[model samples]
Target: MMNHKKILGIVLLVAVSISGLFAAESANTENTVKKSTIIYTIKGNAEETYYTMMDKPIKALGYRLPDPRKHVNQVYKEQYGSTTLEVLSFMTIVNDKKVKPLLEIDPKLAGFNPFNLVIYKHQGKDETVISHLTADAIIEMLGITDQKVITEYRKQMEELDALVAKTFPSAVVSHGTYEGAVENAMMHYEITFDRPEDLDDYIDEIQEKVDDTFTEKGYIMAGFFDYKQGKPDLLPSYDAFWTFSLCHFPYSYTVFDNEGAMPEVAVFAPCTMYMYIKKDTNTLVIGMPRLANWNRFFTMNNSKRMDFLNKLDKDIPATFLEIGAIEVK
Candidate 1:
C-alpha cells in the first residue's frame, strides 16, 4: 500500500541511490492520466465475504483470479509472530479473451496479464481497502495505441469498477492521481538461447537455474503459469509464454509487517514477470512492472522503502543477467 489514512504503509532504510525513471517522457508528457490506482474503501471489514461476494461477478466480467494470495497477513504472522494487517490479499487477475486482442498489438500487455487486485485491512481498522492500478495507467505503460483495443479495454475497466462499487455500495471510492507517473513503467529484458530440439529440455534446465538464482537472492517464485497450456492458439505471437509471480519475503515483511508500515502496497505484491518466445525466433523475451512503479504511484516518501526498491530494481536485472539474460532497454 502507498499511503492510506488508517491506512497503507510499507519498509527498511539503507543509504542507496535510486535509479533514473525508465523513460524521459514524463517531462513533456501531459498529465492525461487522472489516476494510477483506484481504491474502494467500504465501512466494514469485508474479510470473510470478500471472495464469495465478488467471485462470480468478476468471472462473469471475463476476469479470473487464478491465484488469490489470501490471508497473507496470517502467513506473515507465522513467520514473524505478528503483523500490522488483519487482512491482506494479492489477487492476480486476468481477462484472457479480452486481453487477447491487445496482446496482438502489444505483447508487453502480458507484463500485467494478471495484475494484482489488492485488498487490505489494518489491524483494529474497521474498513477494508480494495485497490489496483487503473487501466489507463496500464495501457499507457505498455504504449498501447490501437483505438479499438483501447476503447474495449477502457470499457472493461468501467464494468469492473462499477461491479466493485455495486458489490460494496456504501464504499467510498477514490483514485490516486497519476500526475508524476513514469512512462514505460515496465522493465523489459531478453535472452538469446540456441534452439534446442526439445524446448522442454531447455525450459527444464533454464527454469531450474532461474529458480535457483532468484532463491539465492532471497526472492520467492510464489506462482508460475504456462499461459500456453490449454491455449496454444490463444497467443499466436509466441511459441511459448509464461509468467512468474515473484515475491521477496524480507522486503515484504519490512514494508508491511511492522506496526506502522504501509500494507496497501500489497496490491502490487508478488510481482509478475512474463516470459515468452516469439514464433520463429530463438530469443526469449521477458518483461515485468518495475519496483520503481511502487515508488512513483505511492511516492514512497520513506527512505526505507526507497532502499528496498532501489536494491531490487538493480538486483533483479543483475540476477537475470547472471543467468544469461540481457536487459532490453
Candidate 2:
C-alpha cells in the first residue's frame, strides 16, 4: 500500500498542475478580445454628451441606465489635490426576465447581469468618450462555458448595441480591443459563525452588519443578490448564500476618469462581495475579489491604483474583525 505522505504529495502535485494549466490558458488569451468593444465619440463637450446619455433611454433596448455618477471631480480633488477632467459612469440593467434564467444557470453570471456604460473626457480633449466592455469579453472573463448561455448573452448585448446606435445617431461608433484583465490571483476573506439558535435570523443580522460596515467605510452598495432565495430549485444543494456588489466612488473615479486608466477595468466594478453557507454547515463565509487583480492585468502597475487596491484588500478584513466576524484561518 502507498504511504500516507506519498498519497498526499501526489494529490498536491495534481492540484498545482491543474492550476498551472488554467493560468497558461489565461496567458494565451491576454489582450485578445473575442468581441469588439464599441466606442462612440460625439462632437461636443464631455459633460453635455454624458448628460444626454443619462437622460435618454431607449426602452426598446430592454434596459434602463441608472442615474448615479461617482462624481470624479470631487474624487480627483480628494485623491490628487485638484481635478483636471470630467468623468461619470453608470450602468444599464438588462430586463430582469432576460437575466434571470442566466443567473439560474450560474450565480457567478451576476457579475455582468447589469452591464456598465462609462462617459468621460480627459483634460484638453475636445470630445467625450463613451464605451463599454464587449459581451464576449464579459462572458469569457467570468469563465462561462455553456454554449447556450454564451449565445443568449451575445444576442442581448447586440440588442443593446443597436439601441446605442439609434440613440446616438450622430455619434461615431467603432470597435476596439478590451477582452478583460487577467485574474492572476483572487483575495478571499471569510468568517465562519457558529450556528445560532435561530439560523435565519442570525444570517440576516450578519448581512446587515456587513452592509453597514461597507457603507460606513465609504463604499456604495450597488446591488444585492440573494442567490438561495431566487433559485431554491436550481441551488438545492446550497443551504443559503448571497452577494452584494459594492463600490467605493473614489476608487472607481481613480480608475475610470484618469488619463491612461483602462475604462474596461469597470468590468470588476462594485466588486462582488459574496457571503454564503454550505448545506449542513453552520459556517458563514464572506469574501471579495482583491483590487490588486486590477493592477495585475488591466492597470499595468499604477502605484496610486495599487495603493488604493492594497488598502481595500487589508481594510475589508480588518472591518470584518471589528464587526465581530472571525477571519478564516
Candidate 3:
C-alpha cells in the first residue's frame, strides 16, 4: 500500500510541471504580438488653435475667452492678415493609488470646445503620435469680412482703452513728521503714463498746473526728484512723477511744547493729479507683479528700484505667455 501511494504522488507532480510550462508559453505568445486601433475628432477657432499648441494641455482645456462683444474682439478681413492672438495652457498629473493606464483623456474635453486634437500614447518618455486633426475650416466658416468689420473693430478698441484709463490713475499722499523743534508736513504726488513720450508732456503740463495751485497756499517746492526713468525687463514703461513741499508756519514755537517737541501738524494739501494716454490698443499690458509696483510709492523709493523696474519692464514684452486684443463698445 505504501509503494502504490508514492507512485501516485510522483505522477501528480510531473503533470503540474507540464501545465505550468504550457501556461508560460501562452503568455509569451500573447505579449509578443499585439495590435490596437484608435479614432479622434478636432474642432475650434483661430484663438483656440493658438492655445492648444502653446499652453499646457490640461489648463487650456478649461479656460474660456470672454464674449467678444463684452470684451475686445478683433477680426481680419484678409486671410492671414495681422491679427492678435492669445494662448493659455496648464497640466495636472493623476497620482491616486489605483493601477491605471499611463495616459487618460480628460472628460471635460468632451463638453468644451477645443481647436485642435492630438491623441497619442507615451511609452517611456517618448510620445507615439496615434492621430491628429486641425480645425482651420471651422474658423473660416465664421466668414469675417474687412470693410465694416475693421471699422467696428477699431471702435471696440477705443472703448476698451477709455475704460482702462478711467479705472487706473496716478495720485499723491500727505504725511506729517517731527524733525527736532520743527513740525514738518509733506505731500507726495505721483503721475504715470502709458508711453515714454507721453510722460514728458504730461509731467510738464501737470507741473505748471500744480505750481499755481500750491503757490496760493504758501507751499514751496523743497526738493524735486528728477524723472528716474527705467523699464524693468518684464513690465510696462511708464514715467513716475514725484515732488516734495514745505509750507511756512508763523508760530512754530507756540505750536510745540517747551521741551522742544513740535506739535500742531496740519496737512495743507492741493492737487493729486494723474494723467494717462492710450497710445495703441495693442501696447498696454501689466504682465508682472513688479510692474504693478511701478506706481507703488513704497516700492519705487529704493535706490535700486529704478534698476529693478527697468529690468522687469524690458523683460515683460517677451515673458507674456498669453495676449489678446479685442474691440470694446
Q: Name every residue pair that clashes in candidate 2.
A: none
lDDT of every predicted structure (CA atoms)? 0.79, 0.65, 0.26
Off by over 4 Å in 3: 1-198, 227-237, 251-329
Q: Per-residue lDDT tens digits of candidate 3, residues 241-285?
A: 232222222221111112222221111110111122222321322
Worst lDDT window (10 residues) for model 3? Answer: 94-103
Question: What TM-score would you give candidate 2 relative to the actual structure?
Answer: 0.67
Which structure is stronger by TM-score: 1 or 3?
A: 1
How many pairs of residues collide in model 1? 12
Cα RMSD, each candidate: 13.2, 8.7, 30.6
Candidate 1 Cα RMSD (Å): 13.2
**TM-score list, all predictions:** 0.86, 0.67, 0.20
Assess the local accuracy of residue 119 in candidate 2 as a C-alpha lDDT between 0 and 100. 65
Winner by lDDT: 1
lDDT of 2 by residue, 97-187 (tens): 5665665565445555555576666567677667776777666556677888889888887876776677678888776554545442333
Q: TM-score for candidate 3, please give it.
A: 0.20
